[model samples]
Target: MLKEFKKHCDSTSLSAVCTQLTELSNQAFCVNNGNIPKWQSALDDVQNTQPGKLSFKPPYIAIDTKADVSGLTRSLKKLMPWRKGPYQIGALQLNSEWRGDMKWDRVKNHLRPLNGKTVLDVGCGNGYFTYLMSLAGAKIALGVEPFLLFNYQFQAIRSLIKEPIKAFVLPLKLEQLPAQPLFDTVFSMGVLYHQKDHKLHLQQLMDVMKNDAELVLETLIIDQQHGDQIIPEDRYARMRNVWRLPSTNTLQSWLEAAGFKHIKLVDVTKTTPEEQRATHWIGDNTQSIKDFLDPENNNLTIEGLPAPKRAIFICQK
Candidate 1:
């Protein structure tokens, strides 16, 4: 992944962020190719691991994600996991990764609203959004992703930049991403639903960012409450596609608890519906989950379903 990042940064022009790799990132920048017992188990839920399994095993990478860049490709060049392409940034990406880019014109403004401003991107997959931030003119945009593959991938992209674009890779969890609260804005999108502990995750993110810092949140939300959530037998690291979509009241309360004074729902894409769904954009993704996510396409009404409404919750610390 580090190699890929280096190549990407070299291709672009942001080498500053990755001048030095953290010790932890250096440790995780490689992949262990041999498959472990747990590796086979985690893949298909065939053989599950013990509830408290904490030991590291072979096959350092797991989860078949469609990341534009793959760290697994570094050690073993022959193993090319099916590549998907023609990526497009839409309502979801805009709400999440592109949220900080308040205005649209990327060329004119450089999308760098927080120029000379410290920034942190939690759950930054593939670091594509991080790239956008750099283009926008952010002084520094450090991305944090726990996935071994993604963590190194971000590091790799940083390594290549010609001009310095500050980024760091720390395997630390959201709850453990340092407590300095130095950033001016912390952005997280499509990340809250993936956390096993939603409340704690919320607390952790808020803790890392500075007071009066902007918290841009984008996640799947249900229009109405359902009695129960559909739990997947074995989902993404025990997380859900659509976990807790805290009601506007619940989210408002949590932000307040996290020392956020202003909480507002900036936009609701469901009103338009078509442009936002990944099916319209991520055609590769739709091949598997057909019909895509058009609520109008199908009369489906279940809370937290795949096609649940998505909203952006902006909070000021």
Candidate 2:
């Protein structure tokens, strides 16, 4: 495991961590064949990367032009043949123009000041978007996700960000987050619906935000009124409903319940320039999400897709 971690991630202090992890893994593994020794260094790195922080206005980063595919390859090699899903769509909606900060382009009237302030990104997969947020001038931007496979690579990508940017490999339901200062903004994309107890999970999320802290939330909306839908077997590589999409109304109500005063619907699904969204995850089926969005095609057929559309819901406090 330490060898895997070392192969994928690089940092000045990583060699030390690598050594520690190896010793720990061997000791634990030899002691009981019971559990795998898992240690995450990404979250803890935020403190080290955050000193000497400088403030600057962020430049727009349009991803339409080919991203340095090298970075994508680097992340994928470690993460494995994982596929993109609702999270990407939600990000597109937040920054439909793709200037890159996922802060819902030019919505400052509603968004609080974040330039050089601390920002937290939960369930950040691969850290691509987290990097963009840091470039957008967050004093310290931290991502929390539990997959060591990807977190390893995400940490290596931190160097590209001149400002403080860190990745934390933490469980979605982990009871405690770093407890020093509260975050100014939290970006949680497409993660709310994954838990079994929806209300409790939402409350737990609310616990992390400050009184007026911004929350850029996007998730699979399960309409509270209508019954929840399930993904049938075979449609997904995993079992049905690993994702529990929420309805717009339900999300809005939850925001209010959570004390987020201003709630707005950014868009259910955004229309990205076909070229901008092209990737290994999205194939020739340009109509993949488009087909799902057509109102006439709202039905989740035997073919696939619970609904005919991918929607983005950006709500804030």
Alpha carbon lDDT of each predicted model: 0.47, 0.45
289 Cα displacement, candidate 1 (Å): 5.4
Decoy 1 TM-score against native = 0.59
By summed lDDT, the worst window of 10 consecutive residues in model 1 runs over 52-61
Using lDDT as the measure, which candidate wins? Answer: 1
Q: Give the alpha carbon lDDT tens digit for every residue of 1-317 in model 1.
A: 34444544442223433434343455643446354233322222311211111111111111222332322222211211111111221111111112222211212221226766677778766565555555455666667766654444343333333344444445535654555566777777678776667778777777767767777777655554642343334442223354565555566676677677767777644423322223332323333222333335532432224444456777776
Specify the highest-TM-score model's number: 1
Number of backbone collisions per candidate, in order? Answer: 16, 16
